[model samples]
Target: MAQQERGNRSRRSILEAAARVFDERGYDAASTNEILASTGLTRGALYHHFPSKEAIASALVAAQSEALVVPDQPVKLQAVIDLTLEFARRLQHDPVLRASVRLAVEQTSFSRPAQTPYEQSNATILDLLRQAREQGEVLPGVDLQEATSTIVGAFTGLQVMSQVYSNRQDLPDRVCALWRFLLPGLATPGMLARLRTAPLPQTAPQAAPQTAP
Candidate 1:
């Protein structure tokens, strides 16, 4: 167990060191040597965890979408909204998340293959939207799959734009604006009126009396 825990720690250190190097120098310029130098670990240690830089990039890309799990809410639509809000906040603070975005942005210019970041994001939203629909929070005519696509695509665009324009400092506000625009089309009138576009403080309670069936 101790050996396994130490291995996990070593892998995480390599990933974090690589993320920082990728964040600062970008993929094309970032070297495995630099990543190792940042970790103060031998190249063998990094190679043991990740065989190549591309593998590390892929891991980071996958990590960005999978890392944040919002607290569940009785109002499923609000949970969806909170997911985006939480993601926006994470982007402002998490270098791993930002580095993932950097690799995605520059992926086409380099050897990194096309990735499934959107597909993963879409699945999460689709699950929430399905739950919302079952609870009558979603509009009767809304296509949940289409809504999922739009929400993920719009959020992806906003992440890039906010990073370019404001270094993602305004991302939370931008995400709130996104929810406001999207909710009108996706949510039932009662849900729309009840949902809060802004994220509640982290310390705030998450549960609400379940909405009427």
Candidate 2:
């Protein structure tokens, strides 16, 4: 058990190091040596953990994609918005993510073939959109494929925009605003109303029935 824990720790260190190195050096320019040096691990250790630099990059991409989805959220448009806002907070805090975005922006031709990590991320997001449709959360007239692609594409564009102005703190807020605009038209009226006009919980407990005293 202890050995397994150590292995996991080592793997995380490598990924974090890769994020930093890749962010600083861009894909073609980034060196395995730099990644290894950043983590203070031996070359052999890195090789054991990841077969190649592309492998590390792919893993990092997968991690970032997974991070985009907030856990335990329902399948409504508002839920997706809430989850994405939370994820944006994470990107704001993590330098690695910031760096990755920079790399993605600069490397306009970094497309992986089919069955790549990015494709997997797309598939997962599409599945969620499909689920929302199945649950009758989206409007009846919405085209499932087009809506999914558009929403994902919008978020991707937002991410790039956020990277451009990352020095400012309002990126996430702006992205949320975009979602608010999109949700009303895309969601069923019930879902839209639930998100827009949902009442806040009355935190102050009502006093127990007052006795005549």
Across residues 70-172, which tens digit of lDDT does each residue of candidate 1 receive?
A: 5579999989888888777767766777777777767744544655566777888899889889999988888889899999888888988898899988888
Off by over 4 Å in 1: 108-115, 202-213
Q: Report the C-alpha displacement of residue 22, candidate 1, in angstroms.
A: 1.0
- RMSD (Cα, Å) for all candidates, in order, is 6.3, 10.2
In candidate 2, clashing pairs total 0
The TM-score that candidate 2 achieves is 0.77
Q: What would you estimate as the lDDT of candidate 2?
A: 0.65
Q: Write out the backbone clash pairs for model 2.
A: none
